[model samples]
Target: MGTFDAEGVYHPRPVVADDLDEATLEDAVVRSIVDFDDGDIVEGTVVKIDRDEVLLDIGFKSEGVIPARELSIRNDVDPYEVVSLGDRIEALVLQKEDKEGRLVLSKKRAQYERAWGTIEKIKEANGVVKGPVIEVVKGGLIVDIGLRGFLPASLVELRRVRELQPYVGRVIEAKIIELDRNRNNVVLSRRAWLEETQREQRGDFLANLKPGERRRGVVSSVVNFGAFVDLGGMDGLIHVSELSWKHVDHPSSVVQVGDEVEVEVLDVDLEKERISLSLKNTQVDPWQEFANTHHVGELVYGRITKLVPFGAFVQVGDGIEGLVHISEMAVHHVDLPEQVVQPGEELWVKIIDIDLQRRRISLSIKQAAEGGDVSAEYRDAFGEHAYDEQGNYIGYDYSTAEFTPETEAQAAWADYQPEVEGTTTADEGQSAEPSDD
Candidate 1:
């Protein structure tokens, strides 16, 4: 062997057989280093992290370089956030060697390849994918499910959620509705998952519900005919007619959306998935209460509310009315009811009849006024002309007498007479008609 000094002088040295073999072995080891092609996935340890790139040691001749953009699927990420020194991770080979002779690698690409296989298997098994909401975009949201999954706004909930901002950072489970490998697109629907879950719950709710049972629920919506109430598992309808004992013009008059109310189950149709509820049945009936305390021939004060050809209706109490037939309005041959009574007129009446089963009451104003004095002024003015118990004239008459003070009174009475066909004087049975003058 020969050696060179620092002064560039050649010197002779002793040669060993082991030294000659070591030189030959080093050359063979260098030639035997493994070669890797583009797109190969390799495991490595993060050796360095910088602002723009990361260095990974994958047992290669040189450390692999992963640019900042290739570190994660997220955009504008800092290398420090995606990886740390000495952390084991998998990377995809982007290039065997770049122009600078450094191996180019991508951590995000390796994750994408692994995620595609996992998602396919989940879909085949009809499994659910859970992830956190990452971004809110136009018409939808982006969920991080190993990769970015698009969840449309309409399919986010059972009903469309108006505010998508609140969903950000929330973990949710969804079903895969669409998948395209070539386009790298995935569509998810949370509504489908919810509907399926609710259907099972509804079946159990319907089985346990029975007629005449009371329940508490929230009013979900009001329609012209009824209001729909949410009973936790399903929605039941409260018809307008069943809202109150009194007549209701519309369902909104009794209940509005989000009102909490107690209701009774009136009926249920399992085949059709329908439930009928009654809000009034849970309260007291005013008509039944009035009937329990009132009876026939009892005097009550009321106001005339409506008039028809048959009779007049008077409201004696709240939601309680009694009809007075025209024949009962007065003790005379009355041609019309309005001649004696008018709408909005308040008066006293006696209940003549009651039909509790039919919910009817008959009243009479004339009968209630019976046995009262005719007129106090008329009695004082005609004291001289007395009448018997039958109301017949019994006093003496002076048709052709002299003009005395008493004689003048008798002459004035001779000219007056009653208009009845047979009676020449007012009869006790005859009812007095109010004078027009």
Candidate 2:
């Protein structure tokens, strides 16, 4: 057969086609079919969606079968949930012909192949990848950024998160910290992204915070050394030393996680982006309170709380302790504080010096023996008759003493007077480190 073209050229068909047999015609049709190999990506339209698999028409002799397992990065998902009939999708050719003589394809693998090329470029350009959290695996989560991207639990937030399940289905942005295509590994850090994005906000927060200024915040976390308080914009650390006016054994003993507290800003390091806060500074200082009510050369009854090599700590007021150096323990030479007084023993002592700045009080048992004006806290307990015109302790009979508030207070003062000498005990001596303000 021949046909005439618009250019007036005559085209004649080959005589070989006119003599072709049915077997030859079938071979020619087979040769015209499109072909693809393993790992080759192909575009197709979803033709059938079964419970176990999806059939995609890629213009091949047989429809490609995408098993439900290969439909998505997620496991155990229904084929209908992944794709609908007549919907166009891309899939990677897994096998030209399986044992069942069907072409096998993987949608997830195709997506992974495409994603890797984009992800590598992003990593090179220092870009961020965002996706929804698909699963919570051990020690981390899996994000579907076209492929399974591993987001570690520790990198999910500025602080390590103990519960990762809540992150599932939540879309988050992250920076690629590590990537290895051969191992099928992609490590991400959402914390890196957060820190980069919040750097400016933190700087502003720190700039506005001034020393000695008080701010209210919620305790975000508690650690052995300190507690971190979230002050709206950023978190600041309250060291254990500044947790209380009195000595604190642990940060938890004073504040717990989620506690609302007023804290004083002690310092701010703009270069380091750190804030130092003090919980005690916002409260009354016990040392300052004791100093206001007491003075030098006054007699105050106290209990020997601890005996150290250099001194003995005497509890004079609530949460207030004064140190009696070994040299001031008595008029006579004393080798150890325990030689002049034993722990838990009660006696009167005179205040020698008070250093509010150093948070220290010096007491002297030897000077107290000379007698002085009793502290106002205990002056009422000692009747005027108990002291001479010179304010020296004279003899008083307890048997004749009437049961009154003064006597009750004196009784509560415990036993022993300033004139009493140290008594021996069989108990072993103990020592303790002096506390600081």
Per-model TM-score, in order, reads 0.70, 0.73
**Runs off by more than 4 Å, candidate 1:** 1-35, 77-79, 301-315, 320-437
Clash count, candidate 1:
0
Candidate 2: give its CA RMSD in angstroms: 11.2
By TM-score, how accurate is candidate 2? 0.73
Candidate 2 lDDT (Cα, 0 to 1) = 0.82
Mark the 10 consecutive residues where model 1 has the least summed lDDT.
370-379
Per-residue alpha-carbon lDDT of model 2 for 365-399, expressed as tens digits?
A: 77665556678777666777766676645434444
Model 2 lDDT at residue 234? 93
Which 10-residue window in model 2 sums to the lowest lDDT? 428-437
lDDT (Cα atoms) of all candidates against the true structure: 0.77, 0.82
Off by over 4 Å in 2: 1-40, 57-63, 95-104, 220-224, 249-252, 308-311, 325-340, 366-373, 379-437
Q: Residue 97 error for model 1, in Å?
A: 3.3
Screening candidate 1 with a backbone cut-off below 3 angstroms (N, C-alpha, C), the clashing residue pairs are none
